[model samples]
Target: MLRLLFVGDVYGKPGRRVLAAQLPLLRPDFDFIVVNGENAAGGYGLNRESFDLITGAGADAVTLGNHAWHHKDITALLNDPRLIRPLNLPPGTPGRGAHTFEVSGVRLTVVNLLGRVFMDAAHNPFLAMDELLAQPDLGTVFVDFHAEATSEKAALAWYLDGRVAAVIGTHTHVATADSRILPNGTAFQTDAGFTGPLHSIIGADPDGPIQKFVTERPHRFSVKDGPAELNGVKLELEGGQAVRIERYHYEEGGDGSAAS
Candidate 1:
């Protein structure tokens, strides 16, 4: 069996600090670790420094979401072979959507995909995935479906059932309770939540989202600091079938958000 650890969206500095503190304690149990780092830089886009912080905190590879290129510098850094963006992005986009790694003598392919429901335009993820699977199987496969809709994530999981080992969701920042193995043996989840401040609205200061909803006015939101939360899932894959899936959350000792 191969053990995989996938952490949800790492918001910003708080998320990075939590990972730095928690991963070392959790590292002994997993063979491979993947982290969604789209918002690791000030909760907007990831820069090279944030990328290094995530990888430095024990991430074997970092996956990105729609904000993959929020920082212009990321375009140059995407080709580093460890950072990945959405596979369904337009052709000629910088960086790869899928990455292959060797862990404990087993080859694993991790693919990042963006969902189109109420999201920015992207290629058909299902069709793109079909094309990817058309190639010879490289190794155990996993996907990070960074989407907003649960139905889309579920549909993709069912579409790839029995083909990949797992389809883990990200971008929602709120962990769902539907962690289960599908009929075809692929492990699935709607969202993996987030690793950042728990005292905010999905890692941002709640005031901004609240005001935007209440007053219908644009307001700048900043990543909250203090009392970081780490959310993720641990999976056991055997023969390309997920045998077990578990969700986990860790929080620093505190309750309130730190002053901005």
Candidate 2:
């Protein structure tokens, strides 16, 4: 079986810290690793330094979301084969939406796609996926559907069932409990969750979000400090099908106590 670990969005410095600390302990058990790092730079967008840190921590590929281009300087970094952006972006956009890697002698393709509901304008993800699948020799496939609505994520998972090995949602930052193998052997999870501050508002300082919610006004937010967690899912695939999927969560306290 080909074992793959998909980590959710890395919020900021805290996320990067926990990832660097935990991944080494977790890497030996998996054949390949993929991380969602759109917010790795400063809870906004990725940068060269953040990319290096993630890959140095054992990530084979880093997937991005709507914030993929938040850092204008990242355009050049996008050319790296290890980075993946949303496939539904306008044509001629720099960076690829999917990349393939050889893991344990098997070809594995990792795809990143953005959802349309309540999100920035982009090409239709469904049709974009159709075009992607039409290409030759995809081998075993995995998709990081960075989207907001759970319904949209589920719909795409069901639509692509039996075609892709797994579909794990991102962007929401909150972990979902509904992880299961679909009728056709594909693994599906509504969201993989974020890897960052566990006691804050989705990896950000709670005060800013709370203020914004209460006053209905913009408030500056910063990455939360203190305790953090690493969230992801582990998938086992065989014969181009998902055989099993399990959620992986590890939390570390401010005083250094850790839990799994």
Top lDDT model: 2
Can you write out model 2's per-residue Cα lDDT over 1-260, one digit (the tens) per residue?
Answer: 99999999998988999999988888999999999998899898899999999999999999999998899778999999899999998889998999888887898999999998999987998899899999888889999999999999999999999999999999999999999999999999999999998888988899999999999999999898888898999999998899999999989976756875
Off by over 4 Å in 1: 255-260
Against the correct fold, how does model 2 do in TM-score? 0.98
lDDT of 1 by residue, 1-260 (tens): 89999999999889988888788778888999999998889997789999988888788989999898789899898978889899997788888999888888888999999999989999999999998888775589989999999999999999999999999999989999999999999999999999998899999989899999999999889887668888999999988889999998787776432322
Q: Would you list the clashing residue pairs of candidate 1?
A: none
Q: What is the lDDT of residue 83 in candidate 1?
A: 91
How do all models score by TM-score? 0.96, 0.98
Q: Model 2, 66: alpha-carbon shift in Å? A: 0.3
Model 2 lDDT, residue 177, Cα: 99
Clash tally, candidates in order: 0, 0
10 residues in a row with least lDDT, candidate 1: 251-260
* Candidate 2 runs further than 4 Å off: none
- lDDT score, candidate 1, position 214: 95
